[model samples]
Target: MILTGYLHQQLAAAGVTRAFGVPGYFVMPVWHAFRKDPQIILARHEGGAAFMADGYARATGNLGVVLTTSGPGVTNTATGVASAYQDSVPMLVISGQGSPTTFGRGVFQESFLLDRSASPAALLAPITKTALEIVAPENAAFMIDTAITLALSGRRGPVHLSIPLDQQQLDIPVPPSRSASPPTVGDVPAAPCVLAAAELLRSARRPLILAGWGSMLARAQPEIARLSTQLGAVVVTSTKAVSCLPRDHPMLLGHFGPGQRSDIAQAVSSYQPDVVLVVGASLSRYYANPLAAVLENAATIRIDISAEQVGFRMRADIGIVGDAREAVSALTSAIAAGGTDTAAEPDCSAAELVSAFQKRAERAALRQKPESHGMPSVAGTISRLSRMLPPDAVVIPDAGNHWLDTISLCRAGRTGGVQLNCGVGAMGWAIGASVGMAMAAGQEGAAGRGPLTVCVTGDGSMLMHGAELTVAAEHELNLLVVVFNNRSHGRVRLGQRLDFDREPMGTDIPSIDFAQWMSAMGLRTFRIDHADQVDEVLAAALATRGTVGVEVLCHPDEVPACLRGWIED
Candidate 1:
């Protein structure tokens, strides 16, 4: 067997039988290998394909693998890879590079093909834990192992490995030892920090659990919920962490962010919690203004799997570097051993605090009506969709103004009910991700409970590789893709209109009947012209067994006042 074939075999051995990519000249040989392998699944666009891998990794907890050609192919996949990187989702990205023969010589597709000369592998260095270029076929197996190891190791992230065209096509010997192995979890260090964290939780009168994307990636939901329950703490999630807990639970406070339903910033500042336990969150600037104010006067205990994350931005009072779930388990064990009796007598005021939060949420939900600018309002759409779908339905939103609306309105009672693009905020995430998620839902009996998978994307987002609906149709995936047809980039248009004090230019998109287009692609379709008709259209779409697209054409001028305020602030 040749080196290229052996590499494909290694990918298969690692449980990544499917490989998605956009072919290019440099990757021709590798593409041929995948075509002959009978395992790899080719995709249309690099970005959409990589996101599909992300969804697969999330659902199965296996290292997702994707391949692409150098230059444009690799560049196009930046957003999705960054999303996986930021969220700590394990993924392996193999890209074909210009031949080593073209090193330093001006050649086609030779943009820094070797030494950080604008290569996608170099671009990914800052975001990824490991980035390597295999100039020789012999090093391919070792590099593959290292990349896989790092991707599945502490604080999982995407790892980039580039193989030069010459090396990939070479008829080099395939070493039997080159076979890829299943990634193994390493040792867990003793967590004395857990004892310190437990003491802080015991001493604090008011405590809050702030969970993030890592919570979902690390499967730390149960551990986090247990900790919150034992300490009588309020549980809140970031925008991307919506499904980290059961929203209907008494202790759950819903999402906290610019678009979240609850006034978490106000609550955090005014409520003055004595302790804030943030687990698995990277503390992105979008999540809070400074985070220091939110944690001020509060004993902050940060638990993350990576040491690099400990002092990255928000300084932790007590930093514990290890698996979030394991650290949480240790903390809970310590707390239980020194248990304080809170169960015998309920804290009267704590119950009131929970009620107050719920009341505020209900009031906010009611007041979040459509504000007419001209087109359909994003917030109103989200609220409407929230009402139409079953309480446990999964809402996967692509990044954009529409995402803001969905985050604010769509309510998921528990983890796995709702998923969002939290980390890198990629635009085309929902459609592909919804496909993967819907397949997972059906296999897991999500439909038996009610409506399963739903995707809401803005017109711009929908136009970007929306053709992936073919994948859905081909697979007969149970999914609904709800398009907010504004005929423009709604968020950018609003920014230009409000901030630039001018009508949007270059942002407007040619209007298209997406439902009709999708229907032609062999899927059920619905187009809603009026806001009033949204409920019925959305309801019908949810009930469909196969792929369906409901296009809601709204005036592009319509913008949420809250969003406008956010821009101003």
Candidate 2:
């Protein structure tokens, strides 16, 4: 068999069952090889393809693969790749390149070569863990295997490979039988770090657990819950790691940071815990800075996959450098062995959490019943939908003012999670990502009936990549997309008005009825003009199969207060 066929075998053997991309001239060789093999979900744009791959990886906890023709195709993946890099999602990008014989002869799709200083590899290097090219057909297996390994290993992120058409087509000896790959991540450090962390939580007057992305990547929710219970610690999460503790877990207060509601931030900041345990979160300015009053003088135990990010901002009283699951597991075991005070009173912070949540719930209840039949509150709309959706529905929120409302008001413990792109803050990431997630979920169940996947997006995001919705229709994937049509780049408009103290420019969107637009894409559509209509319309959309869209009319000015904090801070 040729190198292309063998490469496909290797990927499949490694459990990479799906790929996302768009076809073009330079990639015909790949298309011919993949004609009926591991399916490639066609995307409207190269950027959307990468986003789909990222979403697939996030949903399945596997390596995501994306292929694109060289030149413009390679460049178009910039936003998606960078978002994956920042969010630490494991992904592989395959860029089809021009033949070696055409080096710099101005080939039609000449994207990269070792000789060019401004090549595509150079452009993508900073965003990828590695950017390599297949120089010879014989090295194809080794190179592809290496890319997969790097993408799945510690501090997981993306890797890029550029394959020349001739190299992919050349006949080469089939590589020897595949050997089992090495462990994806290293083992936890020996018991000293664990012991110190255990002792701190065991003896502290007040202990708090802050779970974040690392814990999610580690799949250590059980371990985290165990530790929280053992120490009677109040738990909070970063925006990226909101699902780290099941939403229903008693110890879980809420996520605290830029994308989360301000009440949780106020609670954590005012609680003044004596000890802080941060799992898998970098605690960047957005997350850490908000709770400065809590962490200011507290002893911290930091566990993270990356050593560089463990004590990135605040000094750690004890730092464990390893996978979050292993580190958290070790801590839990040690705490149990040390004899936790099971009879002790619950942490004071937990009561504070209940108070904060009660206040938010009361406000949410009031907003749920707006007196006038005017536009519904964005948060109220999201809160109502959160209650209606099943516990397993995968909710993805795009970046916009609507996103702020969704993250802040959308109740957690859904298990499917309210997934968002907290990295590059890309506008339409969820729109494209929903397709990949729906496709992945569908593969695990009946073809068109998987976990109900929903994308909550703003009109601006819909305008950017709404074309990808057609892919959902083409595949008959179960999906319901909600468009919070505030009729402008809502976030930016709010920012300009609040921060700049000036008239908004280019933020106002021309009137375009998204319900009509979604219908044009062959999706069942629902238009929501009143607050009372939300439940009825959303229920109708959820009941339908394939792709369905709900366009909610929102008041342009009403947005979360934290939206202003995100802009000025």
Candidate 3:
């Protein structure tokens, strides 16, 4: 069998049915392999291809495969691949390199002869878990298996494989074998550590649980829920892990840190948990800094699959290195074995805590009257759209002020429904990611003829990868993109206004006629301006078939309530 055929077979056996890539002469063999087997979704740019694969992996919990040619193709994918790396998404990137025979010669798109730094494998090594260059056809199988294994191992991330065009096209006799299994790091934590953690939880009157993206990736929601319920502890999720539990859960205290509502902040500070069980979370500044001062006196027990990450960000009194699900399950079992007693007369019940938090949030929302002198307020628009969408629909918010606004207003109703590249803070991610997410949802058939993705991106972000809308139109995907057209980099301008108190330059951009542009590409387009028109325009866009774009003309000066809290202070 040909090497390409064997690669296809291995990928199929590993449950990879779909891939994303841009076509190039060097990667023609990859196209041939994917022609009839694993379906390949075409992208306008290699970066978009990488983002699509990243989104597919995040949405499906499967290995996302992306193929591209060498040189510019690989370099173009750097940003998306870097985002996946930072977010710890498992992805396999296969790049077609120059023929093995022409190693010294400057073949087309050959990076080695041009510059060593330009080599795909060399450039991706820093970002990917592992980057391998296939020098021989016979090494393809081993390298492929290794790449896949590394991708699924602890601290999962992207892996790169630079295969020469000749190697990819070679016909090699290979023995049939099963796909490589994901690496299994032993789940058993040191018995003493587990006992100590249990004891800490048992002794603390107020205990809290912090869940992160690792919890979601490990599917530890059930264990997390059980542990939180058993201990009567409040659960606070990172922004990326907002979907780990339903927003309506009684024990959920809402997302932690700078963007938290006043009610949540007051409750957390007033309650002042004595112990915090940090599970599968990085405790990075983005999620944990604001709570750091508050949790300074709390005993912290951190659990993570990566040993290096266990105590890297926060001081951990007890650092347990193991899979999130297994570690949480073990702790739960240990607590039960220890016969830990529940509080008879606690300071407050979980129900009471939740009620107080909700009351505060309601008060805050009431105080935040729509400030739309004429145009639609961003917060109001997001709130309305959140209510209009189905409970299971997926929402991918791009980076910038819009991301902060959307997260502040939108409640993620379904587990694992909200996907964001908060790790890299990359703009233009949501557009390509939405395409991949919609495809994954469509393939799953769970949405059932309804729109699967609603992407909220700022105008600056939309313009970067807006061309991918053609891909959605070409595939006839049920996707709706809502662009906040503020005609400037709203985040930058806001920062300048607050920090310098001067007119901003380079932040402002010319307003593009997005509705006309989308319509020209065979998509339904809606132009929204006034606050009163949001509901009608959104409803109409949702009802339309295939791909639709809704451009909301927004005021550049308007900032979300959450942002105002920090800016004013």
Best by TM-score: 3
Instruction: Assess each prediction's global lDDT (C-alpha) against the native.
Output: 0.73, 0.79, 0.80
Model 1, 265: alpha-carbon shift in Å? 3.0
Off by over 4 Å in 2: 35-37, 113-118, 173-183, 340-373, 443-448, 561-569
* Reference-based TM-score of each model: 0.87, 0.93, 0.93
For residues 1-569, what per-residue lDDT tens digits would candidate 1 score against the true structure? Answer: 56578677766676665566778888888788886532455566888878877876776677777788888888878888888887778888888888777877867767684554676666878877788987766666676667777888877889998888888866655456555464677436356778888877877777878887777877888888888778888777777787787666778776666575435556556556778898878787787553567676788988777788877787888988878788888888988887785323333465467668776665666665554555455677677777767666778888777777676666675576677767677778887777666544443232223346778887787778787777777767767788888888877887888799997798879978888888988779998876677667777777777777888888777755346442122
lDDT per residue, candidate 2, 1-569, as tens digits? 67778667666766777888998887778766765546688889999999999999988888888988888888899999999999999998988888888877777866645445246678789999999888887677778778888899888999998888888888766555543442355666568888988887877766889988878877787888887877778888888876676566776777876556546666666666789998888888777677777777799888988788777887888999998888888888787787745434446657567556655554653454431236776767777787788778888999987777677666665543778789899988999888888887764244348678889998999889899898887787788899988778878887888889988888888888999988988888998888778788878877877788899888778756355332222
Which is superior by TM-score, 1 or 3? Answer: 3
Which candidate would rank higher by lDDT, 1 or 3? Answer: 3
lDDT of 1: 0.73
Q: Deviation in angstroms for 397 in model 3?
A: 0.9
